[model samples]
Target: MPPRIPVSEAQIDRVVAQFYQRVRAHPALGPVFAGHVADWPVHEEKIGRFWRNALLVQRCYDGNPMQVHRAAGDVKAQHFPVWLSIFDAVLAEELPQHLAQAWSALAHRIGRGLSFGLPQTDDADPVPYLG
Candidate 1:
């Protein structure tokens, strides 16, 4: 049998809600998101499902995150660090030590992959492989 996932749907909902709440308040991330996101509730629900699919291994999320982020135009590679930082903070505040750490690692990995696929400007390096 597959190993049981310890996280719950309610926990995923809470984390998504809280994380976006903080992201909306963030200086760098807030503006970028505001440009693309017209309806906060819908966006949050979609993201919540994404996380549920990611962590719980559920096939609830349907959209392609890479395509969405790439289409945003303003989602720079540098944004991943700030995004991951905010996400890590949210995870730390919302979950127990083990869960937070595990989620943070996963988030970072996903962020790295997304950032790597983005087009870089002249000032930015061609390489997106982040440590």
Candidate 2:
């Protein structure tokens, strides 16, 4: 395997764009995202900035992701693995092994936080991280 390259904004943009493309096409995830996202281009740019901030510590993202996810209401713990799977696949395709693993770890952490922290309407336990 090649040595891991440092992550860049361009790489972040690529990953976000490709990941969303897959998500928007996925059977389970596509509808969930489409229902919540009214504008794809604008949402994509915001997501790119979010990942850039996360991977590069750029402080470009300021939204409360937890609140946003919670507000989605339809988002359930079951959706997290689907989201992570898509994200992991994109990172692996777009980045070096080390960078993909690093980003995957962060994604898992964030996924877990969102899964467990989001308000639940029912008594079902929060979904555990599958990645």
Candidate 3:
């Protein structure tokens, strides 16, 4: 196997772009996101900045993601795993193993936090992965 490449801004951009494309096409996620996000290109760039800040310590993102997610009226804790799974697939495909693992770990942490913060619905149970 070849040596693993370090994660970079370019890779982060690629991962975010490709990941959202998959998300937009995903059966469960597509409708949810499409309903909320009016502009794909702008949303994608903001998310890219988010990941770049998270993964590379670039400090480019300033928006409150938790607030944004909370305001997404249809989003629920149940949706997190689907989001994570898609993110995981994207990282696996776009990144070296080491970088993927690192990114995955961070994503899991963020996902769990977001899941925990989501307002509980009477019908929905918190997922074990968030615990």
Candidate 4:
């Protein structure tokens, strides 16, 4: 079993960048993100901080992701699957198998956190991947 992969801010930023590269080209989520993440770099930094803090317990940033996801009403339940899939693809392609699994679990957790309107830190079902 893959011991939990250690995640850092830089890693989170890389993952977010890779994920968005694909997401921006996606028909379902691209336009939506494009409309808002105009300052893509800034958005990346913000999100990097969000994930770093949320997943790794780093005190880097603060933002209610649940509210953001809720506001992203366009980001339906199906989107979570796509997100996880893309995330899995990215990690598996870039990181080792062990790291990939760890990242997948975390990504799925993030999805479930949003799916049920709770942070991934709280209890919830594991997320499944699909990208």
Against the reference, the lDDT scores of all candidates come to 0.87, 0.84, 0.85, 0.74
Stretches of candidate 3 off by over 4 Å are: 1-6, 120-131
lDDT (0-100) at residue 98 of candidate 1?
94
- CA shift of 88, model 4, Å: 0.7
Q: Write the per-residue lDDT of candidate 3 for residues 72-116, one digit (tens) a residue.
A: 877888899999999999999998888898889889999999988
What's every prediction's RMSD, in angstroms?
A: 4.8, 6.6, 6.2, 8.8
Candidate 4 at residue 4, lDDT?
39
Per-residue CA lDDT of model 2 for 14-108, tens digit only, reads: 99899989999999899999998999999999998787777677778899998998888888777888899989999999999988998899899
* Decreasing TM-score order of the candidates: 1, 3, 2, 4
Clashes of 4: 1
Instruction: Report RMSD for candidate 3.
Output: 6.2
Candidate 1 lDDT, 41-106, residue by residue in tens: 999999988988888878889999999999888898889999998888888898998999998888
Query: What does candidate 4's lDDT look like per residue over 8-111, in tens digits?
Result: 55677778899889988988778878766779888888988777776677777878887887776455666677778887898887777876787788778878
Output the worst ten-in-a-row residue range by lDDT, candidate 1. 1-10
Best by TM-score: 1
Candidate 4 off by > 4 Å: 1-4, 118-131
| Candidate 2 deviant stretches above 4 angstroms | 1-5, 119-131
By lDDT, the best candidate is 1
Q: What's the C-alpha lDDT at position 127 in model 2?
A: 79
Query: What overall lDDT, based on C-alpha atoms, would model 2 receive against the true structure?
Result: 0.84
As a TM-score, model 4 comes out at 0.77
